[model samples]
Target chain A: MSTNAAKNLFIYGSLLCFVVLVILTIDTMGKLDKRAPEITEEVNAGKKVWHKYDCIGCHTIFGNGSYFAPDMTKATERKPKEYLKKFLLDPRVIKADSAMPKLGLNEQEADDLIAFLDWTSKVDTNDWPPKPILASAIAGKAASAGQALFQKHDCSACHQIQGIGGAAGPDLTQVGARRPDIDWHIRHLKDPSSVVRDSAMPAFTDMNDEELKALAEFLITLK
Target chain B: MKYQSHQIALNFYTTSVLLFLVQVLVGIIAALQFIWPDFFILNFNTIRTLHINSLVVWLLMGMMGATYYVVTEESETELWSVPLGHLQFWATVIAVGAVVVGYIVMGLNPQANTEVFGTRLLNEGREYIEAPRWADILIVISVLLFLLNSFMTVMKTRKFTAVQGVLLGGLTFLALMYLPGMFYTKSMVKDQFWWWWVVHLWVEGSWELIAAALLAFMLHKLLGTDVKVLAKWMYIEVGLVLFTGILGLGHHYYWIGTPEYWLWVGGIFSSLEPIPLLLMVWDAFRTTRETRVPVQNRIGLYLTVAHAIFNFVGAGLWGVIHTLPQVNKWTHGTQITTAHGHLAFYGAYVLLIVAMIYVTVPSIRGDKEFNQSRGFQSFWWMTISMVFIVITITGAGMVQTYMERLLGLDYVTVKATYNLWFWIFRAIFGAGFLVGVLMLAADIFSIGKRPAS
Candidate 1:
């Protein structure tokens, strides 16, 4: 190829691509506000809170940032908001060995951060971060609904099942074998201190009778 | 050195090497923290910021130095102002030092946006461009001074070679792309959109131009290739790089809250990105075989060849693996990205800088000939260990995808259990890579000390 020909190829080809990219960028920018329309004062403040601790340095949002922690794009979808706030204030409260360092954020800051994450969770990512397939495969009929509730309420944060969970609560791998009464299990789940005096486990009054029954049935099958 | 002012490159090269050592050390700390979470008090995020920041600073320093060295000889004159070059170099060094100290000592303040003029006064907390606003301004000043020195020298000669033109173009865009990253946005998606203008456009777009021109210059000098032939191919190669790379920015956009059209634009364009890199490797081999002259600096040639091959594998092949939105949806934030990142950066940019050093340092130091044993050994050690690191990390990523994304396992559970062995092996390979770097440092520092053979 002649030098001039090659130079023109470089110049024109790059110009063409550059022009197209600019047009697409403008179009995308115009559409971004509508796609992620949750930019309230609290959400903006939450974003600042995220930056203040440099959370992107650990946890990613939109699959950008350091890979030290889980992606927070759908964090609010996975964990309850109140639980997330408490966990943020003191991570060790939920999981004793959580490597997340306590950042001494105030209650307001934690709320704002959650708000930011909630807004982020709603952004259209073209179905990014596909749901895990193995969870469905391992989720038996009884375990499916109850297991989801287990994760939703963060039971594994304190309780261990089959030696795979936290140590704060008693090992539930054989809890069903010991406490075989379904009614007793339901009462304990609803009000932990009612069944056993001074129980540290939080009461799950929010869970209905059906959820509590499903969780108990799933727990008994753990053995 | 051909000109007295060419010696300024040595200072930049010196700082670049030192910062490289700092990056590697911090990288080791980060890997350790990954395996054993409580290994340090500073935590993984802070250490990681230092690791990434240093890598960028050192690589830019090396690229700047290489540009100066190349432009002086190409223009057939001394630099416009050696004193200004030195001033720019030290100013950059101080800015880098202050930024490092700020991250280590003060940490990031959550209220930085409010405290400063709509920018972070200390650490910006953004990935890669994490330097505070002051450091960011210093970087711009340093780049401007360096550009002025270079442009004036070439202007005086008024004889522009294709190599100099392309190099200058690359450097100009490199400086321009950085400006978008400084613009802050309250919207997280918009912030990331511009952040990539600096990151993606840089490594994929402008740096490819710089790498291609520098490689062309090196090949022309080392192998006595015809300037016209190299220029023609260089133009074609970098033309394709920019053509594909500019639109390939969509790959990053696919999952960053951008419009859905990115999935198609990013997937198609990025898949084509590998074609130019393949052409680059093919052209290098073709040039080498056609040259009748025996290469005196065999290590330089070895690294140059390796740079092309590894660039094809690391940047081109590995990048395309997940560039498609279909595959990237599963592997977006997994260790798969980490695997591709390590090899791509090391292969494309790291090896290029080191190759430039190997080619020029001997001539600069007045060494008639030097031992090639350490240089060759370091090359194999780093290349082998790096490939292994990528392999182990890729394994970890696939497992992570299956457990976390596929099976719907909790992120922490998969991190704690399924990927432990891969992390261990990755750490081991990282240590091996560090040893190779130390040997490389030894070889570079030993350039003038050895007796001419």
Candidate 2:
């Protein structure tokens, strides 16, 4: 191309792209309220708390930030709110092996952070932090309701089943054969220390009787 | 070196190399923290913040220095204000020094709101450009001073070579792009949205223009190539880079609460991001072969060539692997992104600045022919080690994706168990790179020394 032609292409082309970007940005901004509508006062305060602590320094949200820790984009969806709160306050209490240094947040800060995370979880991220495809494949069949509960509670973060979970908790691949009793599993779920002395597992105090039964029944099939 | 004011570039280059050394050292510490979490006095996050912030500052400083030298030579005029250049350099140095110290002190306490001089201490907690609001302001002032000095110098000559115009334009855009990242947004969505305007746009958008300008200037200086052809290629390169990169910002937007339309837009545009880089690489090689003069600064030539090849691979190819939503769905926020980042930054910007220093510094020191042994050795050592590091880190990232993202295992578990070897290899190769950096420093400092005569 001639020099003038190239120069014009350079100038006009960039301008065209910039205009398209601005228009798209406007359209995106218009749609953001509907897509991420949960931006409340608590969520805004929680965002400041996020920046104040430099949480993004380690944990990523929306795939931005250092990747030293887990992405928080789906944190609210991954763990229960109460569990996340306690973990934020003191990570070692929940996972003894967590590398996260406690940020020493007050209850209000913890609450706000969780609110921000909950809001992030609800944003339309084009299905990012994608569902673990192999998780279902490794389960060897369609996910059962109880199996879904196992994942819903993020139990795999602590417990292992079929060699696809964490090592912090015991391997549950043969827990059905070992325990062999649904009622025992139910009792243990409700109060871990009650069943086993000094169990590191936190009690499923938040799980209802149906959830507890469903989870315990799933464990019975793990053998 | 021909102009009286060209000497100011020496200070900038010296400070930049020192910051480069700081980046590598802090980078090693950050790498160590990956395996031994308690290895450092500071947390990994703080160490990482320093490592990245230092990289950005050093490269910007180097670019400023290079621009000063290039502008004066191209315009056939002395710098407009040498004292102002010195002032800008010192201001930058102070701001960077204060920011680094603030990060360390805050790392000790881990408090975001620790006030110093009536403002918050340390970073704004965002990655990359983590400078506190005050430091950010100081940086803007320093950059403005630099722009004014360059602008005045160019205006004195009343001549606009492609090199001068493009270089100044790139510097101006570099300053402008940073404004979006300065303010805090109440919404995380908005904050991240604007943050890319600085991070993504600077690297992919504005910095590409700077790189093209520098490449053209260096090739012309080294090879006596025709400026008309160089300018034409640069124009083509800049046109395509902006055409693709501006919209390619959509790739970052896809998973940041932006509309789903970005999945299509980001993927398509970013996939095309490599085309211009590839063209530039081809053009560089062809130009090297068609040179009107034999190259004297062989080390500079080597670095410049490496810059184009690595830019294509590290920034273009690696970026495309996950730019598509189909692939990015799993790799987003993983170590795969980390692999891409380290390589892309080193390949695209770091090598360019290092090349400029190699080419210009010897001239500044009045050396007709300097010792090339250390320069050649450092070039090989740094490049080979960096390639190996990128390979190992990509291995780690792939494993993390498979085990953690695919198999639903925990991230920490994958890192501790499966990816430990990768991080170990990364550190080992990082040490090799440190050796290269030291050698380069030694070579640059001793450029004027007679070699065992």
Candidate 2 C-alpha lDDT tens digits along B262-348: 989999999999999998899889999987676778988888888988888999999999999888988888899999998899899
Off by over 4 Å in 2: A138-154, A166-187, A192-223, B115-120, B449-453
Q: Per-residue lDDT tens digits of candidate 1, residues B114-231? A: 3376665667778888787888888999999999999998998877999999998999999999999887688999999999989999999999999999889889878989999999
lDDT of 2: 0.86
> Best candidate, DockQ-wise?
2
Which pairs clash (backbone N, Cα, C closer than 3 Å) in model 1? Answer: A52-B110, A132-B405, A132-B406, A132-B408, A133-B406, A133-B407, A134-B406, A134-B407, A135-B407
**Least well predicted 10-residue stretch by lDDT in candidate 2 chain B:** B111-120
lDDT tens readout by residue for model 1, A1-223: 7999999989988989999999999999999999986699999888877876778788888998888898889887645576688778887765677878777788999999999999989998878877556444544433378777777776765566764444445668888788888888899988887997645566789988899998888777666
